[model samples]
Every structure is written in C-alpha cells, then in structure tokens.
Target chain A: MGPALEVKDLCRGFGSRRAIENLGFSLGHGEILGLVGPSGAGKTVTLRILSGILEGTSGTASICGISVASGNRKIYEHFGSVAENHPLPGHLNPFEYLQLRACLKKVRDGRREATCALQACGLLRYGKRYRIGQLSHGHRQLVALADAILGRPSLLLLDGLEPRQLPAVLGELPIRPAVLVSGRNAAEMADFCQKTIFLDRGRVVVDEKREQRN
Target chain B: MFNFFALLTYEWRRISRTSDFFSAGGLFLLLSGLLFLFALLCYVGKPQTVSPFAFWLGHGWPMVLLLVPPLSADSIAGERSAGTLDGLLCASPAAVLLAKFSALLLHYLLLWTVALALQPLALFLASLRLPFPLWSGAELFGALSLLPLSGALYLSCGLFFSTIARTQAQAMAATFVLLFGLLFGPSVLLRFLPACRWPILEDILVRLGAASQNGWPDRFLNFGTVAFYLTATGTILCLSAVFLRSRPFH
Candidate 1:
C-alpha cells in the first residue's frame, strides 16, 4: 500500500566523523534502486542503517510504514538483507546454509523454501554437492543472494554486491520486491537500475530516475 | 520462540565445527582421564589418604575454570570480527545472544557429561575389591545435579566477555581474569583483613569463596548457591544482549 521503504533526515556518525548525513530516500514495490558511491560515500552505511544493523545517530528509517528505530521484531519480517562481505559458515554446505537462513527468518517449511531458493538461483545441484567454503567467490555471492530472496521479503537490501542482472532473477518472483543495491560502478548501475542515487561524503549528490526500462 | 530454537540449533552446529571446540574437548577429556587414573591409583595404593570419589569431585572446579572461557570466548566476538554479526542481527539480538548462550552452556554441560562418563570405569575397577567403594549413589547424584548450576554462571560470564571484547583472544583473557578474580579475590581479601574486626565480612567472603569454587559439602546441593548462580547467569546474559544490541559500527 505504502512505499516499501522510506528514510528521512538520517544521520550516522562515529564521534565527529559522519558515515552518513541527512540521507533521505524512498522505494516502492517491484522497483529497483541503485546506491552508487565511492569507498567512503556511505552506501554500505546507508544500507546497514536501513537493515537495522546500525543505530542511526539521528532521523528515521521505516520499512513498509514501520519505523526501523522502533526496535520492533516485526519489522524484520518485512525485509531481508545481504551484508558487505557476507560471511557463510564454512562447515555447512550451500543447501544446509540456506535451510539455516530460512529457519532464522522463520520461514514456514524451511526445507521446501531452501530447495526453491537454490533452484531459483540455479545452484541446486552444486549447492547440494559442495560446502559453501569450497565454492568460488561468485558462487558464494549467489548463495547470499538466494538467502536474501528466501522469504520473499517486501524489501531487499544488498551491500557490496554487483547487481549486474539481478533484475532477471527478481523478475521471476511471484511478487517482485523493492531492491536497493550498493556498488561502485556508476555507469553500469545507472543503466541497470530504475533509480540511481549517487552518494558522496555521506550526502546525495545526485538522485536520478531513468525512463522506465521495459 | 521459533527464532530462539532455530538460532540455538544453528549456534550449536556452528560452534561444534570450530577447531576450538575439538581442542577444548580433547583437553577436557585428557584432564578428566588423568584425574580418574590418579583417583584410582590413590584408592588402590593408599585407601586412608582420601576417597577416590572425593578426589575426583574436588578437581572439577579447576576443569571448569580451564574449559568455559575457551568454549565461549568466540561465541559473539568471532562473529563481529568475521563480519557475520550484521547478518545475524537480522534476527532479534536477544534471540541471537540467548541462542548462543544456550548453545555454549549445552556444549559446556555436554563436555562435563562426557568426562563424568568415566566415573563408571572407576566404579567397575572398585568392583574387583581392590579398594573401598568408589562413590555412593547419593554422592554421584549430588555432583551431577550441581554441575550445570555451578557452571552456568561461568559460561554466561564468558559470553558477556565475548560480547564486549573485539576478538576471541581478548574475550578468553577477560573471562579468565574475571573468573580468577571471582574465585580467589575473596580469599585473598579475607586473609588480609583482621578476623576480629571483620567477622561478618569474613563470613560473607567465605560463602562467596565456596560458591565460586563449586564446593560440594557432604555431597549435597546448596540451594542458596543455586539461586545465586542462576540470578548471576541471567543478569550477565541480559547484559550481553544489551551490549550486542547497542554495539555500534563506526
């Protein structure tokens, strides 16, 4: 009914050094947004704040009209996140890892959901055969991606990942969710995302909307 | 509730996979085995010195001191260092901490259970009439019942250290220090104070020393000690959750 995500006047600082400042943005269902910035542009910090991992120094972030600052457990049910350098347990195979993720997210029928997520990621075979630690870097990213999509959350926040063709994957879902991905490649993300927000030193330098791509 | 159980199971599996788990388990088993052997030798060679079971029971506190920190030192700090804490905080921090604490406590208890399983070997040895009885059923029951009660506080304390420390080594060191302080500080203070002027203080210190030492008098459970451990464990666990939730990434 409302936008899937909203942030207003958000500011986070480590003492006097601000990681993100006066950040404001919104995303609607089925829309894809790109957060493009330099190393210290606050892209990851913005994503982390939205995902409830870090407490913002000031302002509000809400998911599906629920404030992230409320510290409500129910807010987590509305979103799934892939963090920068997502850590996968080396001991668990990909399939088992997904099952564990599904379980943590309180997905009903975790096994079935894990199976479907693996299949959707096109890693069902490989995931079953090998531990996540043994997988290539690219494969691990896919596994993390699969985990984010497991519960069909209303909002998906991915940090430090290239969303080159993530739309292709999100398109197949029964109800496409709002996705905000952070990365360094501005041109590629501009071409890929419906809306691209370029951050510099924790401020939005540019927020552009491309003509809707078919 | 669902989150707690899910996270608990995941935590258990995750901790068991670490090399530290195996190393700690090995150390525990080795120490427990040696204690059993020594007790058996003491019984067969010189029955008048001390009962084999009493000797075994007397040594449990040292094993607990040596084992708990290693098991729990990395429970939270390792996740933060590896950058996994962000992913886990997607769940409630309370659930995550509770699950980690539960898993660590379970692992700690499981280790003691394995070590105590050796008690049977001594029992079997005593059956050959080589010495007096190893341990009475009541004595065994008392030790078994109090093991978790006494050990939970240490594990929770370790988890608190893990939550606050930035690395596994720091957590381990902090836990060992805190445990050592709790274990010996009272006795050290008691020795320095004049007994006539501080009789009440001495009495309280004596109780604390016994409580921290996991002392089992007459092989019976002490309800006051049980209450103290449980309350301290719960308080430390709550503090751990609070620290985890408030932990900022600068």
Candidate 2:
C-alpha cells in the first residue's frame, strides 16, 4: 500500500571523509531494486543507514512510513540485512545461529523456521553441529542470507551476493519482501532485480527498470 | 527486558563454546595455582609469617580484576571485526551492550566459583593443615557484591573499546593497556614519586586494588558494594548506549 523503504537526502560522513552524502531513493512494496556501484560508492553505508545500524550525518530514513532514527522497534522488525562480509557468531553452528535469530525476529516455531531457512540456503545438512568457523566463505555467505530471511522481514537488504546464491531467493520471492540488492555486475543485477539504481560517489547516476535495460 | 535477557543468553551460549573463554579460564586457573603453590612453599619453611588462606584471598581477588578485562576484551570487538556487530546493532544498542556485559558477568561468576572451590583445596594440600576459611560469611558476602560490579565495569570498558576499535587485535591491545594502566600504573607511579609519599595518597592507591581495599573484600557482601556496582554498571551501560546511538557503524 506504501513504499517499503524511503530515504530523503541521507548524508553520513566520518570527519573529513564523506561515506555517504545527499543519497535519496524509495522502493515500493514487492519491488526488487538493484544498486550498482563501484567500491566506496556508499552502497553499504546507504543500506546500513536505512537498516538503522548507522547514524546519518543529516537526512531522514523510514521503513514503511516509520522513522528509523526514532527508536521505532517496529521498523527493525520489518527489515532484514545481509552484508557482503558475513557476520555470524563463529561459535554457533548454522542451526543454533539461525534459531537465535529467529527468536530475536519473533518468528513462530523457531526450529522449523531455522530448518526452512537452512534448507533454502543449501545448508540444511550442516544442521546444528557444523560450527560457523568450519564453513567455507560461500557457505558462510549463505548462512547470512538464511539469517536475513529468518524473520520474514518486509524489506530485505543484500550486498554483493554471488550468482549461485541468487537461486536461494527463488523460494523466497513468493512472500515478496521489497529487496534492495547492491552489486558491481550489471548482468547479475539484471538477472535478479526488476530495477537498477546506479550510484557513483554517493549520488544516483542512473535509474532504470529491467525492461528498459532490455 | 525479555529481549535483553534473550540477547544475553545467546551471547553466553556463544562465549561458552569459544576458545577465548576456555583458554582464558584455563590459563587463569593454571597461573593462579602455580603462584599459590610457590607462595605455600615459601610459607612452609616459615609458618609464622603468612596465613595461606588470607594470603590467597588477598592476592587472588586483585588477580581476578586484572584477568577479567582481557578475557572480555574481544566479546564485542570480535563481533564487529567479524561483521556480526551490524546484525546485533539491528536490535537495540542498549540491549546489545547489556547482553554482552551480562555474559561477561556470568563468565566471572563461574570463575569466582572456581576460585572459591580452589581456595580450600589449595590450602589443604599446601599447608598440610586443615585450612581455616579466611572468608567469613561477611567477607564472602562482600566478594559476591564486588564480583559483578567489577566485572561489569570491565565489560563496559571493553564494550566501549569494541565500538571504537576496527579489529579484535586492536581491541585486545587497547584493553590490556587500559587494564594495566588502571590496575597497576598508579601503584607503579606512586612508588617512584616522592610527592605521593603521604598516607592519604597511599590509601587511595591501595583502595583502587581490590585486595587492599578492606571496604571491598570485607564489606563486599554488604549493600554498599551492590549499590556501587549497580550504579557503575548503569552509568557505563548508558554511556555505551549513547555512544552507539551517536556513532556511525561504518
């Protein structure tokens, strides 16, 4: 009924170094938008700011019309983020990690939810016994994906996922969370996203729908 | 509160499985035991000078303070380095820091219990005399009060570093330096500075050490230590929350 995520002139910086500045975008419900940019293009910062993990120097961000900086728990409850560098507790096996995440997201039937997420991410066999540190980098990436989806969040933020992992979302698309994906490859962006927003040095350079690219 | 407890439980389970926890706990036990054995041997030939129970209690408590920050230094910093901190920050920063502090508190509680068990056993074996328990119920009470308060202080300091540090190694290094400076630097400085020869300055320095502070070990079980810990923990936690709220994660 409304935009899933909205950013108005979002600006964040680290002292003299500007990480993100005057970034503005909006995604409608069920829309999958690709964010294309080079390294240091402020893609990750934009995602982090939208997810309420990082404070913006100036600007406003909202998830489903709720201000993120206002400590609105409801906004976080509806959001999910998977960064390029997988951030999972190394001591936890996939199952325990996902289960804990499910609980935090208030997912019903946590064990079942964990199993489904693991299975979807191609990590079901690892189960509760496979420590995160033992997993390969790719598998670790999948685990992060599973965690992001565990709570069935309304808006999903994914950064720099490889193509093999793209299939993992096939089963999740029906639930249709608004997906914002950031990647360097245009082909990969076109393959998974319905629209692409090209960012260069914290400013949007190009915005195109998938059909328009064709 | 339930979210806070859940986050704490999650961290406790995670920490229990890590090499950091096991190695720190094992190293503490080994080193403390070795030091106690050496002291006991020294006392064996000259029994009039030292009470092993009192000596261990005196030395052991301060050692606990020195050990806690290192053991906890990586708790949050490691997460950030591993990129797990962002997911955690998705939850309330207050909840995240509190959970970490609670986990470290649980860790120290377990360590304190081990210290409790080892004290009597070490005295019995080394002294060859049935050990006289130096911790009267009041002293025991005092220690109980001091443990969490001090542990929380250490954790709060660790969490602050975790937020500021970009890597686990940096966090560990910073924590060690801070702990050494806070716990030992003052005494070292006072020893060299003739200006600090006054009884008041000496008393202040001693009070900083957990063992020398009679108020800590003797009155540990009292409400004062509890109040002090609660207030200290609350203040640090609030500071951590504010820092988290103010800073950009990247």
Candidate 3:
C-alpha cells in the first residue's frame, strides 16, 4: 500500500567527501522513474544504497515497505538490481549466470525463468552459445538488465545502462515493475520515465514530473 | 538451503575449470612423479633403507604450501575484482564463504590424493617386490587422517586473506607470506636466536614448526594438534565471513 520505494534524507559519505547528501525520493507501484546525473553526482551511490550493497551515513531507504538497511535476506526478494560496471562470471554463459541469479532469488523453476529472462532480453541464441565474457559490451549490459528483471520483482534498480537500450527493455516486460534507472542522458530518460530527478554534486537539482514537463 | 548448495556447486564448477588450476596441478603431479621415480631408484640398492613412501610423505607439505595459496586466493578477491561480489551479497556472506571454502578444500584434497596415488602407480610399473618394513601403515594413516584438518586450516587462512585483499594477486601474495611465516618462522627463529633458552618458548616453537607438523605424518595421533588445527581454522573462517559481510570500499 505504501510507495514501492521511499528514501528520506538519505546521506552517504566516504570520510570527508559526501557521495550523496540528504537525498530523498519516492516511487509508487508500476511507475518508472529516471535518475539522471553527471558522473560523481551520487546516482550510482543512491542505487547501491537502495539495493543494500552499501550503507548510508544517515537517514533511511526502503523497498516495498522493507527497510533496505535491515540486513534481512528477505528484503532482496522484493527487488532486483543491476550494478554499474559490475562483471558477470566469465566462465558462465548467460543462461548459467541468470540461473545463478534465479537460484539466489529463489525463483521456482529456476531453469525456466532463466531461459525466459534471456529470451526477453533477445539474447536466447547468444546466451546459449557464448560465455558472458565473450559477449560484446552492449550484450553484457543487456544480460545485466535481463538479470534484474527476473522473478518479476516489485522494484528494479538499473544503473549506468545506455539510453538506447531502454525501449527494447521496457517493450519486453510483461508487467512493468517500479523501475529507478540512472543514466547521464536526461532527454532520453525523460521519454521513458514519468518523472526524472536530476542530481549534481550529490544534491537534487530538479525533480520534474510529467505534468510539469507538459 | 537452495542458495547455499547452488553457490557451492557454482564455486566447484568454476574452480575445477580454471586453466591456472589445471596447469599448476599438472606441474605438481609431474614433480611428484619425478620425486617418486628418484625414491624408487634409490630403493633398489637397499631394502633396509627409508621407504620411498615415507620420503614422499615428508616432502608433501611444501608442495601443498605452494599450491593452496594460488587456489584459495582467487575465491573472494577474484570475485571482488571481477565486480561480482555485489551480486553475490544477496546470499548471506557466511553462505558464500562456506561454499567457497568447501569447494577449495575439496579441490585441495583431490590434488593430494592424485599426488599420493603416484606412489602405487610407480611401484606397480617397477614391478619390484619390497620388504614389509619399507611400507608403514601407521605413517599412511597419520598423513591421511591429518590431511583434512591441516587443509582446512591452510585453506581458511588463504580464504581470509582473499576476503581482505583487493585483488587476486595480492591475496595470493599475502596468503603465501602468512602461511610460510606460520609454518616456518618459529623454526627459523629458534635456529637463529640462541638466546631463546626459555623452556616454554622452546616448546611452543617446536610445536609450531613445519618440521614438527611434517613429522606428524609419521606419528599416529596428536589430539592437541588436531584441536589446534580445527580451532584455528574455525576462527579464521569466521573472520573471513565477518570481513566479507562488513566490506569497506570507497
């Protein structure tokens, strides 16, 4: 019943330098929000904190009403994440990699879900044929995207993917989840997102809704 | 439960498939085979002399000392460097650490088994009937019984280093340094520092020495030593899991 994602006064700092300062946002179910920022603007940091990969210095973030900082393994089941510049296991093909993800997510019929995820990414042929390391950079991004969308998670956190890939990704989802994607290209993100939040120097510069843009 | 087993299987598959493992394992087997050949050649002249099997067992620890670091180093540090650690954190760090540790321990045991098998194969090829005194059943039992215990301690230490280090190479180097120090440092210190005439220090040094542990393969049972290995291994594994859970990165 609450927002699918909610962050209030979230702050993350590395010693003296703040990565994100007083960051706050909320997204409802099935709404797609874009997080557009320049490099070092804390977009990735925000996503990492929400995904429970990193701890915040202050404040709170929750996904589907579960606190991200709770250290509860169950929190992971409600959402899926694609980390920026994170590497996939090169020894595994796409199907195998996704199978591992499925196993971690505890998706019933893991093999079938993995196959379907690859098919959704339009990578069924390549996923079967090549190891993830052997794929092109673009394909690897797609594979990472596909990984995030498995299990039909309630919230999806996608970071650092190319803007051009958004259409193919959004078109393939059977039922859209609450998506928060970060990228540098604001114009392209605006096309796919109902709201776009622009960040600079770890502070929100603008929070534009569809009505405001209209 | 499913997550743990799946991770364990994945670690097993990946570790076994590594080309570095194959190449290092091949070199180990080849060198061990040569050592067996030399022992066999030496055996023909004197039936009353030290057995080739005993000699082979004496030299086994140094080979294991070198082999385990490279294997275990790549578990956590390699995952971190490859940037997969974030994705894997979905599972509890304890599960991930346990899975990786089990896979590496199994691989370590397999390599030793293969190396030990060379003894019988060489004997069969030589077709030489040796005197009963040359084969020591007690020594074989001692080595086999203690292998898993010692392997757990060493591999856990290596895994701990991997969890702390930023890169695979750094993990390998740190583990190698720590292992060599733990196994050999006391003996080296005792040899150099004649001023250490205190009885307790002498006893501790002697107990901690590689010469003493290698000598364990000849002795049947040492419960204190077994307890020491198991306790130390468990502590290191716990620390590894803790470090992995509270990973500090910029």
Candidate 4:
C-alpha cells in the first residue's frame, strides 16, 4: 500500500518570498511524524501543502494516493486538518460547530459522530450549548480536536499546537491515523514522533528516527 | 448538494442569531411608516396623486438596495477575516458561495415580504386601495414575482465583492460604490463627457442606466429588464464562485 502521505519536491512561494523549497517526505501508515522548526521556518506552510489547504507552486502531495494537485473533493475524503488559527465560528455553540464539521465531512450520523467525539475529548463537561468563543483557549482546542477526530480520517494534519497538549489530544483519538504535527519545539517533537524532520529556511536540515522508549 | 444544505442550515442559524437582520428590517419598516405618514399629511384628499403603492414603488427598492451593500459586504469576507472560512475548504467554493447568497437573499425576502404585507395594514386603517394591492391577484403577483430576482441580484453583487475584498468594510464600500455607480453613473458621466456626445452611444448608456431600472413598478413588469437583471444576477453569482475558488489560503 502507498504511504498515508507522499510529498515530493514541494515548492511554495508568496510573491518573491519563497515559503517552502523543493521539500520531500512521506509518512507510513502507522507512523506519527513531527515537523520541527523555528517560526518562519516553513513548518506551517509544509503542513498546509500536505493538507491541500494551500496550493504548492511546484511538485506534488498526496494522501492515500489522491493528489492535492487535483483539488478534488475526493482527495479530502481520507483527510482532515486542524489549522493554526482556524476560525471556529465564534457564534456557534460547541455542539453546533461539531455538527457543522461532522456534516462537512459527511459522516453517516452527524449528531452521533459529533457527540461521540465531544464525549471522547471530554468537552461535554464544558457544556455543548456554550458558544465556542466563550470557551477557554484550551477548551477551544479541544473543540478542534473533536472536529478532527470525529470521522476517524486516514490522514490527520495538526499545526501549531502547544507541545504539552499533544498527549492529551492524541489520547482522545478513537482511531490512530497516521498523524503529522508541525511545531516550533524540538523536544516535544522528539518526545511524540517516531520520526522527526527538522526544517530550516524551507528545507529539511535533519531527519531523525527513534525507537519508542517504552 | 449536502454541503450546500448543511452550510445553508449553519448560515441560517448564524444569520438569525446575529440579529443585525431584525435591526435592518426594523429600520426599513420605520422608514416606510414615516413615508406613509408623510404622504397622509402632504397629499391628504389627494390620494390619486401620491398613492401608497406608487410612493412605495419609488422608495422601497432603493431602500432595499441601500441595505444590500452593508448586509453582504461581510458575508464571505468576514468569514475569511475571522479565519472561519479556512475550515470550510472541504465544501466546494460554489457550494459555500451559493449558500451565503441563498441564505442572505432568503432573509431579505422574508423581511421585505412582511413589510409588503404591512402596506395593506396601513391602507386599511386609512381606507385606501392603493396598497401593493393583495386584492388584485395579477397586480400583486406581478409586483411580488420580481422581488426575489432583484434581491438575488443585489445580494450577489455584495457577495462577489465580499469574496474579492480583503476586509468586510472594504467589501461593503466596494459594493456601495459599484451599486451607486450602476444606478446613477450614466447621467453624471454624460456631463463630463460632453465632447463625446454621440446620439447612439448616449442612447445605449441611457438604456443601461437607472432611468430604466430605478422605477421599480414598471421595470419589474418589463420582461426584458427583469430577464436582464436575472441574467446579471446569475453572472455575478458565477463570478463570486470563481473568485471564492481562486482566493488564496493563508
């Protein structure tokens, strides 16, 4: 079977400023990969490209053999992403936002999926009727976690989350999809990922593999 | 599409809860009420001269159009600015844009329809048949039929700019400029372009101007003009979809 995610020679730019340059990487079906970099080091851009949120200027990315270049709805079926600064509609209550996400992903039973994910994330303690904007930042992050975890997607992309929150976020996942995380903290990446790629100036500077320290 | 309808539901709730809608509708009704009262004072026993129907036809559409720019200026642009639009990428841009267009258009129509019904209430109290006359089937149907298309056209114009603009305020400003330009530009432009006053050119410009469109009663009844507005509405909506799809992900 093909890798859960396959990125080859990916290049992205904003006018004269190149954000990512000729980057390539892949994540196997069960492995969790972490992208570690300082700010402006292209970690977020790389994750965006892999998730099909941003169009790469050159080269290709695919999830489960579906190309991001196609920009087709089919490519999103196996994927889910929780972007940094993702605007969870502030006016929508937690349940409403989850239901909206569930519906957007077209899960068979949106309410059930939304409820299950919310319960798994322990967010129901916050009250489903509370507006997302009224929730604490950590609680809001849980809302996003619930959104990504609902459909049990095959590939999950998470960007800019706090290092300490990783274990809590991952523990709520009902299905262990191939997870890719982008963060500025190397120590966190080292602790969580089976493999970690350190990027600087849009290119990978280090690729490290570590056995699980069980 | 499932996405469109789901988005439609979400948008409907957002629109209802946000409550700027009721404020706009209340403002509209207040102005209409003032117009009726002023008509009663200025043209008393001269109902033939300033019938409520004719008076409303003159000011109603412009009032509705005035609300259009601000109401839609934020539709997509606000979502984009708020970072909410990034989460919506899974749904096709067409579905998202169409849902915004439909939801706003429906909200406006319901508000205006209630206002339309009120004209008769005011008329009944004053003993006048000059309401947009729900009594006459053909006349009422003729008057009401074009409202949705016109509302769609107005909302689509705002939605297009909202998607294309960077901020909600900028979107609203652009929509107002474009709307007023289309409405009153020709007469004003003709003054500055006196040197190029060719009859055929002037005639075409005038045909495209508010002289033919701002007169709501006659314009709505004219099949050609209605078709033109509907076509323009469709064209603008298609352009909105394209602009939405082309928006860069930050």
Among all candidates shown, the one with the greatest DockQ? 4
What TM-scores do the predictions have? 0.87, 0.81, 0.88, 0.85
Model 4 whole-model lDDT (C-alpha atoms)? 0.76
Q: What local lDDT does model 4 show for residue A175?
A: 65
lDDT of 2 by residue, A103-193 (tens): 6676788898899888878788987768998998888888888888876778888886774466556465458788888998977788888
List residue ranges in candidate 2 displaced over 4 A: A11-22, A172-174, B39-56, B120-127, B130-210, B213-221
For candidate 1, give the docking quality class from DockQ. medium
In candidate 3 the C-alpha lDDT for residue B140 amounts to: 56
Estimate how well candidate 4 is docked, as a DockQ score. Answer: 0.64
lDDT of 3 at B196: 51
**Which whole-number lDDT from 0 to 100 does residue B175 have in model 4?**
87
Write down the TM-score for model 4: 0.85
Which candidate number maximizes TM-score? 3
Q: What 10-residue stretch in candidate 2 chain B is worst by lDDT?
A: B211-220
Q: What share of the true interface contacts does each candidate keep?
A: 0.52, 0.48, 0.65, 0.77
Query: Residue B173's C-alpha lDDT in candidate 1?
Result: 96
Candidates ranked, most accurate by DockQ first: 4, 3, 1, 2
**Which regions in candidate 1 have their CA more than 4 angstroms from the true location?**
A212-214, B38-54, B119-137, B186-208, B211-219, B248-250
Q: C-alpha displacement of A199 in model 2, angstroms? A: 3.0
For candidate 2 chain A, the 10 contiguous residues with the lowest summed lDDT are A164-173
* Local accuracy of candidate 4 as per-residue lDDT tens digits, B1-250: 8889889988887788775767867888777755655554555556455433344444554666567888898789888877788678678888898888889988888877777778768777666554332245543455466556657777888999998888899889888888777656766766676655587666445444533233334444566756677788889989888877776545
Please list the C-alpha lDDT of all candidates, in the order they appear. 0.79, 0.73, 0.81, 0.76
lDDT of 2 by residue, B67-170 (tens): 76566667776776666676666567888888888887778778777865786677676665533453356654555555566667766777677667767677
lDDT of candidate 1 over A1-214, digit per residue (tens) = 9999999999999888999989999999988899999999999889888887778999999999999888776776788788776777776788888887887777889898888888877798987799887898878888888898998899999887777648667876788889899999988888778999999999999988997433
Pick the winner on TM-score between candidates 1 and 4: 1
